[model samples]
Target: MRFDIITLFPEMFAPFLASGVTRRAYASDQVAVRLWNPRDYAQGNYRRVDDRPFGGGPGMVMLVEPLQACLDAIRADRAEDPATQVPLVLFSPIGKTLDHPAVEQWAQSPGAVLLCGRYEGIDQRFIDTHVDAQISLGDFVLSGGEIAALALLDAVTRLQPGVLNDAGSHQLDSFNPSLDGLLDCPHYTRPEVWQGQEVPPVLMSGHHAQIERWRRDQSLQITARHRPELLAKARAAGRLDRKDEAVLAKIADGL
Candidate 1:
């Protein structure tokens, strides 16, 4: 899959694309990434891309003209049929919050054009005309959409085959369906005893069933304590079986 990122600070992505475990995905072209700077397409002595908002805002708004020109160049380079043109995604406060499912979907897609807005925001006209989708990290705001874009790319890239050393690692990640959308259990490594605490006996028992049961119990407890809403969702979806309910019941009873 290919992602064309339109940003004013393309340099910010250079190190990110080259570093991390997900770099394997980029290096092997499994998740092809191309950065485009809208400033390059801006028409001015200073090549400005932002301007004062018409309604008199505190911050400047990204110009639609430069962004449109950049998108045009990208479309020509992609050379895809108009009917099959990839979605243009903008990171914004009003968009759907990104999550595991969204990342999974993007991982399997043909990829998209990611528009990273700067200053106050992009011109509303440009967003309405060109953007096909919008995604938000959360309720909070950022200086620019660059960080959000990086987050999305990293999440999607890591899900590509061979990106992680362990093929099944992500399957056990928090919010994955394999774990029934539960946060992962605590993990201990190396020393059986750390400081004064010893690794749980089940973990060292060489009994897979007992170990898995212990992990399930821990996962249920942690989720109930930290994110009870997820447990509620899992229960609503009928993903919590008898054994799972038993664990949750014990947690509720303070056992």
Candidate 2:
């Protein structure tokens, strides 16, 4: 999949694409990323890309012309017709909050054009004309959309086949379907004894069924304590079975 990012600070992504396990995805073009600087398409001695808002605003709005030109160049470069189905995505607070499901959708898609707004924001006219969808990280704000874009990239990249060393690792990730939409259980590594703590006996027992039961119980306990709402949703979806409810009841009773 190809992700074309429109940003004023293209340099910010250089290290990110090369520094992590996800780099394998980028390097192999499993998740090909290309950065475009709107300033490069701006027409001026200084190649400016932002301007003061029409009414009154503290920060400058990104210029429409430069962004339009940049987007045009990208479409032409990709030989994409004007009516092509590629989605132009803008990151903003007004959009849907990004999540695992969205990442999964994008993981299977051909690619998208990601607009990284800066300063106060992008020109509304440009967004209205070119953007097809918008996404937000959460309720908070950021200086730019680069971080949000990278988050989506990393999430999607790891879901690609062969990206992780363990093929089934992601299936056990929190919020995944395989875990019945529950948070993952705590993990313990290597030390038979650490400081005053010992690895859970069930983990050391090498009894697969018992170990699985222990982990599920731990996941239920942690999720009930930290994100009860998720547990409720899982129940509403009929994801929890009688055995799972019995485990949750045990945890609730201080077991």
Candidate 3:
């Protein structure tokens, strides 16, 4: 899959694309990434990409002309059929909040054009005319969409086959379907004794069934305490069996 990122600060992504385990995806072309600067397509000596808003906003708005030009260049470079052109995605607070499901969708897709807005925001006209989708990280705001774009890229890249050292690693990740959308259980490593605490005896018992049962109990307890809504969803989806309910009941009873 390929992603063309439009940003004013293309320099910011250089280090990120090269670092982290996800870099394997980029290096192997499993998740191809290209950075494009709107400024490069801006006209005149100043090469301006932003301007004062017409409605008297406090901050400048990204110009539609430069962005349109950049998008045009990307379209031509990709040479994709108009009918099959990939979606253009903009990161904004008004969009759907990004989540595990969205990342999974993008991972299997042909990829997209990611617009990283700067200053106050992008010109509304351009967004309405060209963008195919919008995604948000959360309720909060950021200086630019660069961070959000990177977050999405990383999430999608890590899910590509062979990107991680262990093939089944991501399947056990929190929010994955294999875990029934539950948060992952706590993990302890190496030390038979750490400070004053010993590893849970079940973990060292060499009994797989008992160990899995212990982990499931821990996951249910942690999710109930930290994110009860997720536990409720799991129950509503009929993902919880009799044994799972028994564990949750014990937790609720403070046992």
Stretches of model 3 off by over 4 angstroms after superposition: none
Q: Write the per-residue lDDT of candidate 2 for residues 1-255, one digit (tens) a residue.
A: 899999988999999999888899899888899999999999989999999999996999999999999999899888877676579999999999998778889989999999999999999999888899999999999999999999988899899999999989999999898888889999999778999999999998989999999998888899999999999999999998898899888878883
Task: State how far residue 53 of model 1 sits from its true place (Å).
Answer: 0.8
Candidate 2, residue 17: how far the Cα is off, in Å:
0.6
- Among residues 3 or more apart in sequence or in different chains, the pairs in candidate 2 whose N, CA or C atoms overlap within 3 Å are none
Candidate 3: tens digits of C-alpha lDDT, residues 2-91: 999999999999999899899888988889999999999999999999999997959999999999999999999999999999999999
Candidate 2, which ten residues in sequence have the lowest lDDT sum?
Answer: 77-86
TM-score of 2: 0.97
Best lDDT goes to which candidate? Answer: 3
The TM-scores of all predictions, comma-separated, are 0.98, 0.97, 0.98
**Which run of 10 residues does model 1 get worst, by summed lDDT?**
246-255
Task: Supply candidate 2's per-residue lDDT for 220.
Answer: 87
Stretches of model 1 off by over 4 angstroms after superposition: none
